[model samples]
Target chain A: MLLIDDLHASIGDSEILHGVSLEVPDGEIHAVMGPNGSGKSTLAHVLAGRDPYEVTGGRVIYDGVDLLAMAPEERAAAGVFLAFQQPVEIPGVPTMYFLRTALNAQRRARGEEELGPVEFLALVDTKRRLVDMERALLDRAVNDGFSGGERKRNEILQMLILEPRLAVLDETDSGLDIDALRVVADGVTTLRGPDRSALLITHHQRLLEHLVPDRVHVLAGGRIVRSGGPDLAVELEAHGYATLDSPAVEPRTASAGTASIGTISTGTISTGTISTGTISTGTISTGTISTGTAR
Target chain B: MTAMTRPATARRPPSGTGVGMGVQVPERAREPEWLNAARRQAVAWVDANGFPSTKHEDWRYTKLDSVLALPLAASSGRGAEDGPGSVSSSDLPTPQLGVPRIVVVNGGMVPELSTLGTSLPGGVRVESMAGAVRRPEGRFQQLWTRRLGGYPHALRALNDAEALDAVVIDLPARTVVEDPIEVVFVSMPTGDARWSHPRLIVVAGARASATLVETYLSVAGAPSVTNALTQVELGTEAELVHYVLQGERTDSFHFSSLEGHLAEGSRLSSRLLATGGRIGRHEVDVVLAGEGSQVDLDGLFLTGAGQHHDNPVLVEHAAPGCTSRQLYKGVVTSDGHGVFNGHLVVRPGADGTDAVQVNKNLLLSERAEVDTRPRLEINADDVACSHGAAVGRLDPEALFYLRSRGVPEREARAVLVSGFAHEILERFGSGPIRRHAEELAAAAGLIVLDEDHCSSGAVTAGTVHPGRGGRAQ
Candidate 1:
């Protein structure tokens, strides 16, 4: 449902994402793992159409439509949702009021009839149980004085209410406790369907245990260096990203097969053997490419 | 005191016949000895101090040039065709919260037009000032003689000098009046320029409690000047809630002085709202005279294009254990200008005094302007006193958040502005008073939505109708 081709973006004088290419097909979940300053959050913001991040090159196609040409609200109306890393606290505006306005605005933009108060409240109540959000929180000013866990749950609640076609989760597990992570992961798992797509951006593989993805891509130096099955996450966890810096290792194509194993020298600058072999489970492709070190 | 003189540009009209001169006073022989002497003294004081110049500290931000240039005449007994004579109780701004109302047309109290019952509670007196002054031994005479000139103000002296009548409310000791006393002053100018000076005196005896709502409204596009003075005295342990609403014509001017004196353990809450007039000024001076007294002062002013409003409040903590609070908010749009000056003083002997003052303003347009000065003069060592003042526009992030949710930009701004004013309006302590304030604010194009609209499933936002002016409909 989403296709990003050589997307080059920058903020001010520094270019964050350079020639990054990836795709999340319909009905599949993809995870992007990168270290600090890997442009993980920057990619999410650019997708949500936030300002000041100039898209200098390439394009994004969502369901065959030009995604970069739409305004933020227009993107939201067109079923593009980005769960922010930190939800903004809007004082004097109640949460329920904001939700109803947003729901109606999106529905109106899509030529759908607006829901009445009773109908909107009924829908909200149904979604509130899915995310375990308190009714009192809905009555307060949007995220005003809310705890870290409550803000994440509120974001999930909004996602459930809007029921967008594509969802982008940026560091959704950054501040969650063990129980909150399970609940949030369950919320994302429940949103899985044949037509829905999701891109999970995180620095840790712990969240992957709760909500497993079909594809795991290691993003480093503003590019996706490797793509493999879910086992790639387990491998990255066992050995840290230091192994990915070996000169012998190269970029891998996702069709290379399931478990594209490589052997490397056990020294500071490891030299590993890259292989691209097709297995019955999946395909893995590896080739020699410039290994950009993580900053 | 030295004799005050006018500037070189000040024109001296015919001294014996003009409005501010000595001709407006009543015949000396027809009045009581004390009344005649008081009026003569006031008139002499006003002549000595022509009019307050901008150089005076109190009138620094407000200019009276346009107000002084108009030729002022006393209102005739016959009410103008478009005055209060044509207005029904249902047509009032806050008809939803009805109370026993007294109507004053031009400057004189109209008994036929008033809605006061034939009899009031025992030990409570509500009568016209003219009637009270005529009585041989009335309580109004005693209260007036003791309270009329308690303070020295040039415009207040002018009001007392040429005042024709007033509304005098007296509550005896230990009395608790249930309903609020509503006094509506309607100004309707004649063909030529005219001005009205309406005076009111309220005295709450020891342990007495009451609520007073004073409303000043003028007909559409009336060219008139309303110079009003109100003096309040609260005895030991008395409680009083005073609310004043000023809604006049955009082409007219309004000047009012509210002076309050609180005695031992007395509690006073004063609220003032100004939403009309080409230029309006409400000066309030409050003194906590006895130990353990408390006072609360709140005001809100909304000004649009070509309008100017000023509020200068002075609160004095004189006795130990006295407390005072002042919060004033203003929203200026277009070319409108607003001013707020709050001065709080804790005397040397008032060691246990507690005072807080805050003034916040929102400027909606590039041309809009606000001048806010919150001054604190703390002389007592054992006192807690703080003052704050802020002037800015709405938070850009908050605005963007609202707009991102599909609320139109104008409606979002209106919501923020309403919320800013709601902080002070909620302090009214009752739903009816707050609702009344919301109605008045809505009439001024401030976009106040009903509570049901928010709690219910309705997603409709409040709309702004600046063309409606101050009319209820």
Candidate 2:
């Protein structure tokens, strides 16, 4: 459902993401793993259309629309959600009020009727339980004085309410405790369906344990060096990114419109392996997807 | 404490000090001996020393050149052809239900329009300053004479010389006023330039507690000026909550001086919201006189094109173990100017005094300007005093956060701006007054409160006293 083709982007004088490409088909979750300063957060910001990150070259295509050409708010209306790594604190704005405004704005943009206070409150009550968010927190100012876990859970709650077609999680697991991580993972997994997809960005493989992804890609030196099954996450967790013998110069996919995406299955498949959720690297090499094989 | 100036003998007759100088006094006939003597001393002071210029230290940031140049005359208490009577009453806020309301048109209190005759709680007296002057004895006599002893302010002296009437509220010892006393001053400018002096005196006796609200509003019309004065005296253990809402027409001018005295163990909290007038200025001078007295002064000013607002606050800690805090915020846009001058004084023998002053401004346009000054004069040791000032535009990060959530840029800006001003607005005791203030903020574009969120239906307007019909235009 999403295609990022040779997305070269920069912030000021520094070029962060240099010619990176990735693709996630319909109804699948992908994990992007990278070490410190490998531009994981930068990639997420660029996808969300944040400013100060100039996309010098390449394009982002989501559901056949030019995603990079859209503003941040327009992208949100078009079913592209970016869960910020650090949610901002908006004082004097009630949390529930902001959430309802956002939901109504998206709905109005999509030519749907807006929900009233009663209906909106009922929806929040149901989704808030999914993340175990305190009811009192919803009455306070948005993210004001909220603990780290509460902010993360609030983000997950927003994701569940918005129910976007494509979700980009940017290091959402960084500051969460094990319990919060499991709650956030479950929230994201519940949003999974035949028409939904998510890109989980993190440095640790622990989050993958709860919500296993269909693909794992290791990002280094501003480029995705290797692509494999979920076993790669376990292998990398055992032996860090230093052990991966990635090629020094990898071929870049020129354009998302012309690039051949032959191996990507557009149809829904079984989740038999995700329930077991554990397969060794030795048993997954036959099904491993590599950047060298995309062309 | 600064010594009060002794009343000087009348050098010139009241007639010589009248008319062309922007001040007009009534006939001295039938006036009390002491009041006549006081008005004579005030008129002589105004004649001897004209209005102060910007060169004066206190008037440095505020220029009186424009006001001093206007061709001004005393307002005719009766409505004129082009006065407030010409405008519809729908623009004014409806008075809250069951509240004791005193309605002042122009400068004089219209007894027919006022609603506080014999309905006051026990030990409380709400009367006109004119009536109070007739029975000047005991506390009323003492407080009124003490005010006349100080004639250093030129404009205040002018007010004393010309103001014909005022609202006098007396809360006797141990009296607890259940409902706030609402004083609405409506200015109706005549065809020619006119000015009015509105005065208020509130005395909360020992252990007495009450809330007072003073709202200044005007109908849109020719140029006019309103010079107002309020005196508050809190006795031992007394508590008072005072609010001044100044919302005049933008082309009119307004100036108010609030002087308060807090006794031992007494507390005073005052909030001032200034959002209208061509040049709106309010000077607050509060003295924490008795031991253990406390005071809090909070203010918010919103200035748009062709408008200027100034707040000069002076807090004096006179006795030991007293506390004072001042927080003033300003939002200036396009051709607007704002000024905040907070002066704190810790006098001798006033040890253990705690004071804090903060002034913050948000300039929304390149042409907008604000000047903030915090001055501290400490003569006592072992006192805690601090002051700070900040000036900036809206937080761009907060703006982006709101916009990123799909809120339009205009609505997002409104949210952030409202948030900035909410710090002061929320302090306005909740209900109709606060809701009216929010509506004023929204009208001035400082905020955009959601219709349902504001609960404005509770404060349905149009119940205001319709403007009096005088000569047709």
Query: What is the docking quality class of candidate 1?
Result: incorrect
User: Among all windows of ten consecutive residues in candidate 2 chain B, which has the lowest summed lDDT?
Assistant: B464-473
> What TM value does chain B of candidate 2 have?
0.88
* TM-score for each model: 0.81, 0.86
Candidate 2 lDDT score at position A129: 94
Lowest-scoring 10 consecutive residues by lDDT in candidate 2 chain A? A274-283
List ranges where model 2 is wrong by over 4 Å. A247-295, B1-26, B79-92, B136-138, B149-152, B448-473
Give the TM-score comparing model 1 with the true structure, all chains together.
Answer: 0.81
Instruction: Give the clashing pairs for model 1.
Output: A117-B457, A255-A283, A256-A283, A256-A284, A256-A285, A257-A282, A257-A283, A257-A284, A258-A282
Tens-digit lDDT track for model 2 on B1-473? 01111111222222322233434344456557766677777766766666766766677677776776555465655422234464333443685524587777667776656567466778688877656766636555677678674764677887787666778899999998877788888777655536778888999989999988888888756767898989999999999998898988898899999999999999999999998889999999999999999999999998888998989899999999999999999877777888898999999999999999999887777777888888999999999999999887777666666656766555566566666787788888577767767667766666533423422111121111111111110
Q: Using DockQ, give the best candidate's number.
A: 2
Candidate 1 lDDT over B314-417, as tens digits, reads 99999999999998988887778889988898888998999999988878777778888888998888998988988877775565555444444565667667
lDDT of 1 by residue, A1-295 (tens): 9999999887654466777799999989999987656678778888987676789999999999999997777777788788877887776566787787678777877889988888888999999988888888888877899999999998888888888888898888897998888877887888889999899998889989999999998877566878889999988888977688634233432233223222111222212232333222111122222222112
Where does the lowest 10-residue lDDT sum fall in candidate 1 chain B? Answer: B1-10
Candidate 1: regions farther than 4 A off:
A8-10, A24-33, A62-68, A107-114, A189-195, A214-295, B1-31, B74-86, B94-96, B118-121, B134-139, B145-152, B454-473
